[model samples]
Target chain A: DTAVSQTPKYLVTQMGNDKSIKCEQNLGHDTMYWYKQDSKKFLKIMFSYNNKELIINETVPNRFSPKSPDKAHLNLHINSLELGDSAVYFCASSQAFTGIGEAFFGQGTRLTVV
Target chain B: SQQGEEDPQALSIQEGENATMNCSYKTSINNLQWYRQNSGRGLVHLILIRSNEREKHSGRLRVTLDTSKKSSSLLITASRAADTASYFCATGGGTSGSRLTFGEGTQLTVNP
Candidate 1:
């Protein structure tokens, strides 16, 4: 079974369109995260949720919002996506909120905004 | 701002050779983790070395951490073409609740 899975493996949208990506983890992890990989392959943590509660929020713009309905699911919604939003987004989960545990990552969703 | 910076932004090696990548971080960390990302796949956890530990080994992957220098190195022995991928070193600690700060990855190309 896939420990972590995200939908819409590839997404292409217009400049002003809005889109949402869904992520789910079956590892029974307590913390889930969203990371953005830019064209340079630099991975940056955008948001993190611990047991359905928002814990870490980076310097991301307000256009991107992460919602965790439960401990197993974390979804990302982007409002008015722009050209700069064209990048790969990955979903990850860890057994605990600490870094001692390894994180399981899902296949990334590549977003291309025209 | 990125917390870690990987040395030798890109590397090319023939199969059966060894690949070494270095990582330097800006702050104190509880632990350092290395991850690999294939051409179109998500990043996979390779190995981790704690701040107090000096070196660790997992199969052909060897990781070394130097807290005093705030630096780390990942060595992959007998690298194969399948090992071609971007390697990233991430530092986890600080007041952000175990949040990981990643470095710009090092792209390794293992040619057969």
Candidate 2:
């Protein structure tokens, strides 16, 4: 079974559009995260949820929102997406709220905004 | 800001050679982890070393952590083409006790 899976591996949409990306993890993890990878290959943390509670909200634009329906799923929704949002989005899960818990990332969803 | 930043954004080496990548972090960390990402795939956990540990090795991969200096290094010995991917260093530690913060990955190309 795929431990973590994301939908629509490739997304292409015009600017000012709204899109949502779904992510699911069957590893029974309690913590989930969203990371953004820019053109420079820099992976930056966007949001994290622990047991469906929001934590670690980076300086991301308000247009971007991350939702965790349950412990095993975390989804990202972008409103009024802009050209600057064109990048790969990765969803990850960790065992629990530990200091050194390693995250299992999904095959990133590449979003291209025009 | 990124917690970890890797030097030499790209690396190319022949098979059976060794490749070393360095990462520097800004704040104190409880532990550092290494991950590899192949093309069209998610990142895979390679190894993790706590701050108190200086060096650790697993098969062909060696990881060294310097807590005082807030730096770490990943060394892949006798690499293979299969190791051709991007390597990232992630640090986990925050006042609120949060998840890991990954670095700008180092793209390594192992040529056979």
Candidate 3:
């Protein structure tokens, strides 16, 4: 079984459009995160949730919103996506809010904004 | 701002050779972790070393952490073409307390 999975491995949409990427983890982890990887392969954390509570929200644009219905699932929704949003999105999960544990990551969703 | 910075942005080596990548961080950390990502794939956890620990080994991968210098290195022994991927060093636990920040990965290409 896939420990962590994200839907729509590839996404292509025009600018100003709205899109959502869903992520789920079956590792029974309490903390989930959303990361953005740019063309240069720089990974930046966007949001983090622990036990369905928002814990860390980086300086990401307000257009990006993360929703966690349960501890095992965290989804990202983008409103009025811009061209600069074209990048790969990764979902990860850890056993706890502490960063000492290893994280399991999803295959990643490559979003291309035209 | 990234907490960690990896040296030698890219490295190319022939199969059976060893590959080494270094990472330096700005702040104190509770632990350091290394991850590998193949093209078009997500980052996979390779190994992790705590602040109290100095070295860790997992199969062909060796990780060393120096908290005093706030740096770490990952060494791959007898690398294979299949091991070609981008390696990233991440530092965890700082002022934010819960952030796991990653460095700009080092692209390693092991040619056969």
Choose the strongest candidate by DockQ: 3
Write down the worst ten-residue block by lDDT for model 3 chain B.
B91-100
Q: Write the per-residue lDDT of candidate 1 for residues B40-103, one digit (tens) a residue.
A: 9998999978888999999999999998888999999999999999999998875335788899
lDDT of 1 at B75: 98
Per-candidate clash tally = 0, 0, 0
Q: Which stretches of candidate 1 lie over 4 Å from their true place?
A: none
* TM-score of chain A by itself in each prediction: 0.98, 0.97, 0.98
* Model 2, residue B63: C-alpha shift (Å): 0.4
The true-versus-predicted C-alpha distance at residue A17 of model 1, in Å, is 1.3
- Compared with the true structure, model 2 gives a TM-score of 0.96
TM-score of 3: 0.98
Candidate 2 residue-wise lDDT, A51-90, digit = tens: 9999879899999988888899999999998999999999
Clashing pairs in 1: none
Clashing pairs in 2: none
Residue B81 local lDDT, model 1:
96
* Stretches of model 3 off by over 4 angstroms after superposition: none
In Å, what is the interface RMSD of model 3?
A: 1.1
- On TM-score, the stronger of 1 and 2 is 1
Better of 1 and 3 by lDDT: 3
Per-residue lDDT value at A33 in model 3: 95
Task: Choose 2 or 3, whichever is better by DockQ.
Answer: 3
Q: Assess chain B of each prediction and give its TM-score.
A: 0.96, 0.96, 0.97
